[model samples]
Target: MNHNQQSTDGIHEDDAALSEFLASLMDYTPTIPDELVEHYLAKSGFQCPDVRLIRLVAVATQKFVAEVATDALQQCKARQTTVVKDKRDKQQKYGVNVKHQEYFADSPSTGMDPASRDE
Candidate 1:
């Protein structure tokens, strides 16, 4: 679908594109044009331009934080699924963790008993 198309949820594809663009802007200088800034300032009904800009930045920051939090939760869910009975299965499915092999051990009891080992 094109950017102008409206989805079942009533949000236009352009809205999503705009949101993505704005999120990317947060990563750089966020050099919004003065005319666009003035437009938003006027639409916001705020008398002071400084306060309007502050509120706009605050909203953008909040949106970015929420998106990051949601992504983290999704990653946690995917990681949780890697929990299986066999170590080889987990390794085969999720690959080995060379940095921390113990984290993906097939069995927690697989660790050697230091007490039983004769020094």
Candidate 2:
């Protein structure tokens, strides 16, 4: 493989694409029961634990970590988009003024303005 070559044997066009595909492959969660387990074991060459408890724990750990990583990526992307939009608005000098906030709620106002609220 030449250094100047655009294409490689294993690598695709962009690294991000390959990484995302690998991430998705690792993120698969299946409800494999005892019957399914026996079937898979007979088909595959690798050795798996006979203990049902350990298999369940492995499945749960894989699922939890994948979900957490995917969620973190999504949150980061959303925040990045918001920051980009804010930066664009600032550049434009729009008449509407809004401040960035992390209310942990859908709406910062939450249907009740502090100035107008009785409580």
Candidate 3:
């Protein structure tokens, strides 16, 4: 097929898919209620007589909110993980230093006997 014909076919396919999607919206209930969406839309001075369009808007809003909430949760979890890792690193460093100090304080080469040091 010619390039122009191919482009025309693609547009027709897209239109068919869009129509199918809008029809499917009627069967699906969004997390955000239709009444709530209508109320807010009316408040915002937006008017649409089509229920499918309202449902589409509601589904889109629900998806946007869910994505934002998920991102925030992920960031919170990542920050918590970072904090736990830092605490563990600090404890490991301090524990190693404490062990080294104890080893040196009791070593015979340091000219200090363990019993004398304890006293």
Number of the top-ranking candidate, with lDDT as the measure = 3
Residue 82, candidate 2: how far off, in angstroms? 0.6
Q: lDDT (0-100) at residue 58 of candidate 2?
A: 49
Ranking by TM-score: 3, 2, 1
Off by over 4 Å in 2: 1-50, 94-119
Query: For every model shown, what is its TM-score relative to the native structure?
Result: 0.32, 0.37, 0.76
User: Can you write out model 3's per-residue Cα lDDT over 41-111, one digit (the tens) per residue?
Assistant: 99999999899999999999998999999999999999999999999999988664444434444455467
Error of 3 at 43 (Å): 1.8
Off by over 4 Å in 3: 95-119
TM-score of model 2 (CA atoms) = 0.37
For each candidate in the order shown, give its overall lDDT on alpha carbons: 0.62, 0.64, 0.91
Lowest-lDDT window of 10 residues in candidate 1? 25-34
* Candidate 3 local distance difference test against the native: 0.91
Off by over 4 Å in 1: 1-49, 85-119
Model 2: per-residue lDDT, tens digit, 14-86? Answer: 7777566546544444455445555565576545554443345446655787999999999999999999999
Clashes of 1: 1
